[model samples]
Target chain A: MDQREQGKAIVITSGKGGVGKTTTTANLGTALALLGKKICLIDADIGLRNLDVVMGLENRIVYDLIDVVEEQCRLEQALIKDKRNENLVLLPAAQTRDKDAVSEEQMKELILKLKERMDYILVDSPAGIEQGFRNAIAGADKAIIVTTPEVSAVRDADRIIGMVEAEGVNDPDLIINRIRQDMVDRGDMMNIEDMIEILAIDILGVVPEDEGIVVSTNKGEPIVLSNNHKAGEAFNNIARRLEGEDVPLMDLNNSDSILAKFKKFVGLS
Target chain B: MSAVIKTKIEEQGVILSFNPDYCWEEITSALAEHLQEGAQFYQGSKLYFDLAFKDWRAEELQNLINLIESNILPETDFYFMNQSSGVERDNKATPKEQPFSPRSAQENKYTKTAGNDTKLIQRTLRSGQSIEHMANLVLLGDVNPGAEIKAGGDIIVFGKLMGLVHAGATGDKGAAITALQLAPTQIRIASVISRSPDEDKSKELRPERAYIKNNRIVVEEVNL
Candidate 1:
């Protein structure tokens, strides 16, 4: 059960807004915790803090990341425990202040402190290519680039990929979110190969554009908590891959024969 | 002037028909507005340049190419390289030292005219990376999206091309772009520019070459 290793900091960033950066952080954190690793999820979006709410720990947060950085609260005091899972913790951002509230130096020092106690530190970066992005990756050892299949999201993702690679973070893996298989089949959407030809990087996973993600998100419980949700399963697969497990990429393309059975089991079939 | 850029979505994909009659500025502005209105509708497709009748100038063509590129959705699996026809390109900017294939040069002298210096790159070009060659450029790997390859002469890729490529970067209309899988974000040849059709992987992938013909950019499948 002791899958603990030297803590690694990974920053999840999408240069475009609404490409599911916060959603990914919450799901991966919850999934890793379920896999028996102690993980700390940090919302680095500053005034746009969202990780706490996504993880359903919003009301429980008494102290935030800024409080810990300013020494107004201890690191342990700032972390809000997950109500559903005891192993996971949320070090959320301050909603009142902008990204300038936390300096890169302070964030790095805080990440170092968190490393001593947790196995993985996941930082959710804010949208746009600016100071918030720099502060988010300043202390990370690896990066995860998230993008939707849309042109604007992909363009911003490419810019973010260049920025992260320039920052000397380890090879950043790409996650193509909100991929609609039907659209791909109908010649209206970009498929995995099409995206690979452009991004030219190892893919982490692809999450189908699922209404379930929005539903689960609004419920304040990550989709990863539900086994039936394909997006949730994909997020779980990402967590396993992050643990250095060689998980096969989930075929999000409409091969529902195997998937439907995997999700629904009964004597009626 | 407002009718300079005409668009049609056919079974092959979207065809952006540029009217060579209008000046570059009018055409560029109209094209920008057209693309902005349909970016979502054109997200994953490549567009063809119907440039068959226009007399293209290298500088004006370059500006037109840049304008199309600046307006489209560059990411999202969309590309702009196409093989059209009937347009004549300006081939006046060939460099002095193109000798990569002396044996083939004689055969190409009358037909494949352009470029002297040839740069061969052997690795995948990732996003945001740009490769510029004053003469001819040949890459052996995939040119990913957000990355661009600009050559003053001809550009060739041995693998997939899904990025921005400007052949005849210095305005040689005789320049052509060839790729094993010739789908790019945008393509510029001499002074004629065109975007790729929306990418649809379900189609059989083939090696195709794009060059100007009859004053238009045309794409034809190549055996070798």
Candidate 2:
């Protein structure tokens, strides 16, 4: 029964492509919706309409962001309601058109309109520090940068973080995604501290590399739909953190961080 | 060497001042050569070419633009300002500007770190960030890998110093660098430079200091 003044637009971006920007956006949006928050996801990666597919709403899309902007459909008509969660909806990108199809002003206009209906509007940005990135962050209130444990990914994350900070996005948080347990165990990969040291930003949470992600993605179902999976549980926690809760960072050193949680639950410390 | 270009970093971005006498091709080539190594710092930063002296022809200017654009970092913007001021566009709300402190430069002949030359920084310096000061610099946080701190006087860090640091940047042999944790990727004093050993540092990390002793840089433990 809490209708806020306006919704927050968050842009999920990674300078290097395929670092789970789309996947994180999908999972986080779903998790927020599950928490009873009205969520709307925008696939700002124009010419690459993947969020709709990831959300399992690709087949039901009759209109998209470009359609709404170009006056081909009403803003209400372009919104595709999530089959599972009525509070969740998605405005897919135009696959045939490139990033130039939408200007920064157009993006701001679309996002502003959506803010009236949703508690959160998550924009999944296209990779690379180009025009698309400019358009994606144009209307964002906060930015969540996603990166992996590799050196290249961290470097790109640093660059992207610097850009976002330069763009005046206040205090962007980082999400270390697809972390390999063996690498952390072997001391071969950069740990959470190492990544944070280099990037110098707050940690949202770490999601272990899960094969469940691939399966759920292929099935057009977000992993966050169920808490059985560790990756899903990770997103669920991140949603709480985004909602202003103090969720601790997911432990990466132990592959199963839940064993300790159960121990604490049983009063075993 | 004769100077063809000079660059200054500011709150707005990097200001590239060109020698007005140089031709467009000459200026562009010189910039390309200089930026080949320094581009990593200025890449993805805003740049304004201060070309007040030489009125260039349109074709030559276009050619210069083609060459300079390739070397620029992604999302980096370059605007040409004319004497009459073609258009004024200022992006004031950039969320990611460098942590810049406005201060006057220090004199090289100064003997000690005194007055306003010394700066006290209370946060970590992440990768791609650099701090260059002419006097003593004190940092209360860790200097992560890929960052650098250069000073003409003593440099003391309350936390880890894991990046590149040059204490005697202005050829002052008396300058010393001290840190709570000194595991820098590279260290320099005056003209000498040293790097972290490639071999695994099995030894315990302890507080240490580096200074020029007998005309050579030496590292020693600082006993409490």
Q: What residue pairs clash in candidate 2, if any at all?
A: A165-B95, A165-B96, A166-B94, A166-B95, A166-B96, A166-B97, A167-B94, A167-B95, A168-B94, A168-B95
Give per-residue CA lDDT, model 1, range B55-158, as digits (tens).
55778667766766677775312223223432223222333323222332333333322323367899998764778654578999999754678765688999
What lDDT tens digits, residue by residue, belong to model 1 across residues A7-114? 889999989999999999999999999999998999999876777667765545546887787665788998878888888888978765578768889989988888
| lDDT by residue for model 2 (A1-269), tens | 35667999999999999999999999999999999999999999887668876887654555678778766589889888998888899988876557887889989998998888789999999999998999899889999999999999999989998888888898999898999867887898788778989998888888889899999988789999865677998898889999998777665445356666323311100
> What is each predicted model's overall lDDT from 0 to 1?
0.75, 0.77
Runs in model 2 with CA error above 4 Å? Answer: A1-3, A253-269, B1-224
Candidate 1 RMSD computed on C-alpha atoms after optimal superposition onto the true structure: 23.8
Each prediction's DockQ against the real complex: 0.01, 0.01
**Candidate 2, residue B211: lDDT:** 88
Worst 10 residues of 2 chain A by lDDT: A260-269
